[model samples]
Target: MQVNSEWEVPKYELTEFKPKAHKYCVCIPVINEGEKIQKELKRLSHFASVIDILILDGGSMDGSLNHEFLFSKGVRAILIKKDIGKLSAQLRMGFAYALSEGYEGIITVDGNNKDSVESIPLFIEQLDKGMDFVQGSRYVPGGKEVNTPLIRKIAIKLIHAPYLSIIAGFKYTDTTNGFRAHSRKFLMDSRLKPFRNVFSTYELLAYISAKAPRLGYKVVEIPVAREYPKGKIPTKISPLRGNLLLIKILFGLLFGKYNPRSE
Candidate 1:
């Protein structure tokens, strides 16, 4: 299976389920990504030989990713049908679920190919080096954002970056990027719970990163390669609405309104 410049997915030959071979488990939360789920799945499935892989779906309509398929193919899956909120809520749900199931660490990625799944190994390697949280940043060295529109890029630098830095009280080039790794101990640090942003996952990450230094967790970002599709995959959010929700999360953090559950 070779992927070309045109972004074609090669045929995947299924293999057996083997759980005793790996130490970590990865959790991906996706919603209504039928066309691209398999590609992410292929990236995950191939890597599952070295780690446990699980998919938490937010009630996808086409059902392209179901338990029967994942079970037969060795991937664990969980499907939910609560339209409570946005990306952050779904991820909170997924991470909490994966943690309950005894995963050592968690990696969150966009369902789209915007991030290359191959970076997982690098994330884990860094985790072993005494880092608690690892983030993927396009602005970092070796990290490149492909197919990013001019307007979005401008908005990120001009608006989101500054706003997030002040609100989260940390300086990060790409506060909105979803590709990240979190250790089990980091996840169990309940001081960062009670997330408010449901529209986008970045809000939750920013909240956590802001509180990480206080929690004594070492946070770091590494350069990662991103590939964007010619026609961007549809997000479950409109940019305006997503930004509005993000603002709410920002102010929530600013005014001392957020109170996470006790650890």
Candidate 2:
């Protein structure tokens, strides 16, 4: 359960914790989610079997982190002391904690309240069936997306997704979606080395999605609803900069610059 110091990026500590027992842990990466997180946690509370609800906070300054509801719901918060590529750094902390705790799998959903907490059972089912990486896709059959910005929607379907699909050698409907699950076996694989400092940003998810299939692990996409409440701007992405970083990460993986196999 010892974490290698070389892989550590920003130091973080978990607080306001209560332990429980279950097969899966839900990792919600957040930063100033505000009132939306309250609704998300309330919905997730109904999923009684999820042992841990780890809130990975990227230094929220809006007083959202101080909300009393989170502590009441038995949610453990890991506050990253520094901003080091917000989402990816938070995820690395969650993944490391989950591995150390010996959970069977970890499920990641956006903290902005866009993704459905109901689909969690579906993810756990796939993990039980031995699927290594389960990606949530709104573009898939039976999936739903509401109020998504036109440009972002188009970018996902036309450019981002298709590009990743091509590199993965498999058809993917939503490669950019952060709603996904990873079995412990997949996370602990030496070939995937997800804890490396190179994954301090958005590149880790993309790398794992493509690398899992390439490494001969079972990967599947499941339908999930992603609903953006009207007038709520997504905090995680900036159209121009996000797209540029994604393109750069894609090419990095393509050229084996970020590929674990090459390392």
Candidate 3:
């Protein structure tokens, strides 16, 4: 699809280069994120002029769905009324839209504004360097994990290790992180189902990293700097709940609950 340059801001022009190297579609799936969407949008809008951007909302009643920033050049907002309350399902819809729009790649990020939008270039960099999926690692060297509490950190390690090993036979320290970029061919070949409407994006990352690599798609982690606020949405997710969800995804992977073949 040819981008309309008139929609671009003064300092930015719609990047017209056909990414023959990669026709990746990017999705920033959002929920009730009113305060931070604009900032995130401005940063993303200015950054990925060459890629199609989709900001999908799952029935955000906070009126955040009406944000004008979503209409900026290289960005489009999708408001889904069937509120499923899960990050993965919302992302699945966004992926469908991106695919329908002829994008050959997809990237998913949290909409709560904790992610550093500047790191998007780094993701593209990794993708361009021949990665099927470039996952953001907060614990990797040179990557800073700001405001993550000690307790949550421990829980993250415990929950991720065994579940990832049992299901995908892989060991990644930071499996629950949401920041991910995917190649279209990988997504098509892996044939994993949309993440159930019950879990967050964490399990989705686990399934992909474990399953994709086994299928011959190059999966690698890139260091990304993350900054969380002093008392925001608590990057410290509940250990018990998170572990239970991880277990579910593990079972799904093992028993074939997610039928990538159906895709």
Candidate 4:
């Protein structure tokens, strides 16, 4: 793939996934996930031969990035300063690095370890077949969720998924899932403008989920397992604040608030 010279790729520390050629990079966006990240990195080690791993850390003070296990697992870390914002900022940083590095595509998985590492290959498989966006769906036929919080589950199924599907004009089982793959071409597309300031929050993923289909990209969802440990909070989403933000994003998409050309 030809690299785009226009994007001013910011400098960051780099570590190799291993001494080998890799066509795709798996980007795991994280905050202060200490032991959870360690465990997830170990789980992802199983695919070291097939794909490279990139850990995008949003100023983890827990020293999770410094853990010896991450190095042993051959996962690369891009530590973003806290001033950049949260999940969305880290993702933008990771995606920019991946594009500049010339990866064919990038597969994103949350660092919380809620998602199955086994589905990584499935994402790459679809990417290889030229899918622009490969979304992981726990509600699909072969997918399942374990120990999910009742309220969160209800919101995802009844509100988030349905609203996104309607806006995108496509039937979708999971729209809020972070376990998805995006072709380098799609990320580098100027019209999408994923690195814009508006994406500094949680809206980036949702916006891209809806924007991809609207822009005529091949978007598909594959079943993947999501398990919340017993007695553990399933997500970082606060019902009131997160839902309000989501509603704002949905309305913005409908009203052309985030359109690149409108800026």
| lDDT values, one for every candidate | 0.66, 0.82, 0.63, 0.81
Clashes of 1: 1
Cα miss at 236, model 3 (Å)? 12
**Top lDDT model:** 2
Order candidates by TM-score, high to low: 2, 4, 1, 3
Error of 2 at 45 (Å): 1.1
Model 4 local distance difference test score: 0.81
Q: What digit string (tens of lDDT, one per residue) describes model 3 on residues 1-263?
A: 53223221111112222232236656776767777766777677775566666666765667764545456544644536364445665665566555545666677777777787678778777778878777787877767789876656775667665566455554565666778898767765535444344334444556676777666678787787677778745433575676676667777767765545453
Please give, for residues 176-241, the per-residue lDDT of candidate 4 as tens digits: 789999998888777888876677677888889888898899999999999888985745667677
Candidate 1 vs. true structure, TM-score: 0.81
Candidate 2 lDDT at 162 equals 91
Judged by TM-score, which candidate is best?
Answer: 2
- Taking the candidates one at a time, how many backbone clashes does each contain? 1, 0, 3, 0
* Alpha-carbon runs more than 4 Å astray in model 3: 1-22, 79-85, 190-203, 232-240, 254-256, 259-263
Task: Return the lDDT, model 2, position 201.
Answer: 75
Better of 2 and 4 by TM-score: 2
* lDDT ranking from best candidate downward: 2, 4, 1, 3
